[model samples]
Target chain A: MVMVPVVDYLRLEPEPHLCAHECTSCGARFFDRRNACAACGGQGFVDAAVATDAVVTAFTIVGFAAPGIEVPFVAAILDCGGTTVQANLRNVTPDADHVRLGMPVRLTTFSMGEDTAGNEGIAFAFEPAEQGGNA
Target chain B: MSDDIYILGISMTRFGKHPDFDAVDLGAQAALTALADGDVAMSDMDVIGAGNLLGGPGGFGQMLQKQIGQTGVPVYNVQNACATGATALRTVIMAIKAGEADMGLAVGVEKLSGAGLLLGGSKAADRDTWTPSGRVGAIAPTDGRIGTITMPGVFAQIGMQYLYEQSYAGVPLELFARISQKNHAHSTLNPLATYQKELSLEQIMGDFMVAYPNTRPMCSANCDGAAAAVVVSGDRLATMSAEQRRRAVRIRASVLTSDPYTEGCQVLFDVNTLTRRAAEAAYAQAGVGPRISISSSCTTASRPPSWCTTTT
Candidate 1:
């Protein structure tokens, strides 16, 4: 099966890691390019990689969505190191009792839908980390 | 040049589904109502600023003017997402302040219902083609893992984060419910508001969940409506009749600022930071103190509690 990233920010191969850019001057990280550091107005930056393992800072279970899309899915903001990534929480039931703040999570991928050519589209998500194991 | 700006007339259509009317129709109706309210003829207007986030066949200002009879006045179309209305008003104010026009009109209209399938179409193909790919000439990421989350989902995540970090006495969800309850109650006093019936905290909490931690009541409803205002310079106000002058409201200050890049650091991306900066600048320009009252359409549970002190 072939996989494609939903956004350019995610990298699927060689262990799923997010592609990010870090400002050389102030150490600010961004999922996209920053011609100049917004924090310090510095013009230099370098490519950076963000790990899949993250801690849930905040999350929600959306109960309404468009057609063909399931409701009550977990959408969350995860804190990976100092950078935050807005993604979905998976491998867990979408309910208040199942999801908790500060829960450790690891990057995972899923199939979105297939194209006319039968190509499966993929996107990234975070799942609950196993006990004493990396996500 | 410390020239004062005053709003001579203000009008808004009832906020509800208006399937029959498009953006232009709504804008024209509101503009006409405002002109009537101010007792100012449309011919007296020097310029018009029209704002709309979603409108078919652009040049909405010109289309609206066509309905009201065009006088060949310059019509500027403004689009800034949620800030469309305020941006339109600000544009007219700046033009007047620059001595471009003594009397100007600003109108904002929206027809979300007319957007049809595009309103919440979540199909991967639909989103991939319509939404920006982040980089030019590149396909946007289509990972299923990210899926499609709406604004409520985004705010709900922020709300959850605030609940975990802040030390509040009551249940965090209750706080959000209280906000919805208060806003709904306040809307009852506003005839132009979409939902005017008061809602209890329990009722708000019981409403269908649009996003976890955010019920339907906590979210803004999609409604078609338009609002308009006539703004004039101090000199123009002085020349108006006593009745028109008495109805004029002073616009002490107007400021617009863009959000700063947070380097994906959602924790530091508190909108209050931008609000505080803009508020401080506005107060300084208006020569007002922190004691002044404030009314804002943007309200989220993630907003700092300190903001409540400024909001009525």
Candidate 2:
């Protein structure tokens, strides 16, 4: 069986970390490919490593979802250094007390599922770092 | 030769589930009614613009023409997210401003009777098996995989962010419920609004939670609706009947905007910035801003409304 990062920016090798295309002109970092910078309209970009550790800027315990998708998950806005990252809070109880503003977390990954061709998609998330595993 | 544009007439279909009628049917009803309201026939329209999001792959303008009349004039189809209707209106306004057409028809229609979550055209994530699905997930969207690429989750984040930044007076959950309560109460006065009956504050707070800080009542109903307006140049209105001229509402200034660059907008989609920028520009162009009105309900108000604290 072979494993691959679900998203292009997620690098599974060495450690599960995020990479951003930083605008060379304005220093604005973003995931995925960008043709032009939104900040300065700059076309040039360089690869910048995202800090694995992040602080919870905002979060919500989602109670509803679409078909085939489960509910009661915590969606959060994480500050990876100065850049913003969106991910679900894993390995923690999905509630108000479990997740809060200014909570510290680190990047983590898990198996999503395997296809008929035996290609497993690995997805990344942030776990509470300051409180061991589940805070 | 005046470049000013005025709404000759406006009409809206009853906002509710039109299971029997499609989006085009709704659009046609509004368009025809608006034309009659202006006391003008379809032949008087010089151009047409239509906006429909989930109608189909076929553009709404041409299909709507089939229902109304085929004038063979310019047809512009707009698919802006929530501004589809506003964009269609503006499209007609620009045609009048450019001196291309004296009178135009603008229609915005959408059929969302059973629509689920607004995912911004992203494919739903498959939970059981790994497959190439939406941009956010191949296998699954949840399970701590990534941030929400959905609208409900985005609103939840916005509300929480507001509470965190500002020392608000009310509880975050209660405040969000109050916002929904205010909207539901206003619907009672609007005969065309869907679900005109008001829900008590307790019912709103006790409803099922769609997202944190947001209940099912807070979210907009996925009902089919369409609105159309007849727009004409100021000079054209003066030449029309005195009744048409008297009923016309002059549009002084309008501003439509998309997201501006903030590094955060790439992931979370910053709607707050867009509204803020649009409001500021609108005030400058119209030479007016919010002011206390001498309504019978409130004679002396010291503080801004609750909704004002959220944006500002």
Candidate 3:
């Protein structure tokens, strides 16, 4: 098991934004990027990023793994405003005790590991606003 | 009933674990078998619908076609998790029904044993925390979030709910075993089946539990195999003799749907309901009902609730 530095995803500048298809005709919003608006077949869309703050809608503390990595981290579905994004919560221990639905959170980055071919693969992580703000 | 498109022939490799073969190898075997079974040449195929659960990188469809020496046929890859095989079949049937092509083929190959599920290069504890269960490690969310519950947990919750609702404290462990037994029996009948020796209930139950109430045998084997079918339109069907056409199975219906939103519950259960709706639509299109005498039709009943989870 190798210990690697993990970073938050948003700080990676040019962080991938969640694209939503907006209907010009009916004013409907959809998560997937589409050529034509599903509601009105209008070719309209707006680039949207996960809101800076979100809630830990649901999370699971992972106890299963290989070696060298810390046990029990949280992976959460953050509902920022109206959109829900899946991200890993960092800093605090990932368990039922520390995480809660609707808890305020912010975008961050983390380190993943070496890739399949052995290249370093860094990742973006999210953390609770209260804990991450000081650092 | 009137729209043409008939399955002229079908073939499948014995499903089982094969570390030696890649998905393309399995796909090619099924493709060749279907071609031979239908007495149709590979050169006659107008299109190829190749379905795979875990398609490898670097243009999988072309790679699959290259294996069978049938390159350059507009190869279409249809991937949709466990239902991949049937969805590939539907793609070919729809092509024929739409009159886009008179003769088409669909092939599905899965090489589960080729390599364990790709988990981000993390340690066992990390994988365990992400996966929580199963020998195949869970892929950590490198995208930077934790508590991303995997499908096993989702389906486990579903089973839990079913348990609570049904009030059967016995657990559905036996149901999974029964399923494994039935499939294993079917496999034994299949000469190409990966596992020939049938396991006893004790054996199935005794195998390491991957998820609660779901053991190794009770769950679908993670093996490498391929299935294929050739479909031709009725216009071409009339040219063939009664004996040649007797084996043709018609496509009564095909439907696909996705979850609109997550209401904090597993969406896997909705698949059967949606599939049933599609079947109803297909039945109306064919002017047939459940009361009508029919030879055979596949159902979602073969799907374990766990397989339907979005995250598996």
DockQ for every prediction shown: 0.47, 0.51, 0.09
- Evaluation by TM-score, superior candidate among 1 and 2: 2
Predicted candidate 3 versus true structure: per-residue lDDT over B95-171, tens digit per residue: 87777778888988776664432333234334322221222112343321333233433343344444443555453
Q: Each model: TM-score of chain B?
A: 0.85, 0.87, 0.75
Question: Could you tell me the lDDT of residue B30 within candidate 2?
Answer: 96
Best by DockQ: 2
For model 1, residues B1-312, the per-residue Cα lDDT tens digits are 449999999898997888888788888889999999989978999999988877534888899888996999999999876678888889999999999999999998887753432233334545433223654112443222353346666566656666766634455567878877777788889988877899888888888987777788887666788999999999989988999989899998888876665555433345544566677788888888767745445322222222232211
Clashing pairs in 1: A6-B141, A6-B142, A6-B143, A7-B141, A122-B143, A122-B144, A123-B143, A123-B144, A123-B145
Clashes of 1: 9
Tell me model 1's lDDT, rounded to 2 decimals. Answer: 0.73
| Candidate 2 wrongly placed segments (more than 4 Å) | A113-120, A133-135, B120-144, B167-170, B292-312
Q: Write the per-residue lDDT of candidate 3 for residues A1-135, one digit (tens) a residue.
A: 332223222323465333334456655555433567544567866544446677655444444333333544555555667655555677766443465554687766545566444544345556778944422
CA deviation > 4 Å runs, candidate 3? A1-135, B55-57, B67-72, B118-151, B172-186, B260-262, B265-272, B286-312
Error of 2 at B151 (Å): 1.7
Badly placed stretches (over 4 Å) of model 1 are A1-6, A33-44, A110-123, A130-135, B114-144, B167-170, B265-270, B296-312
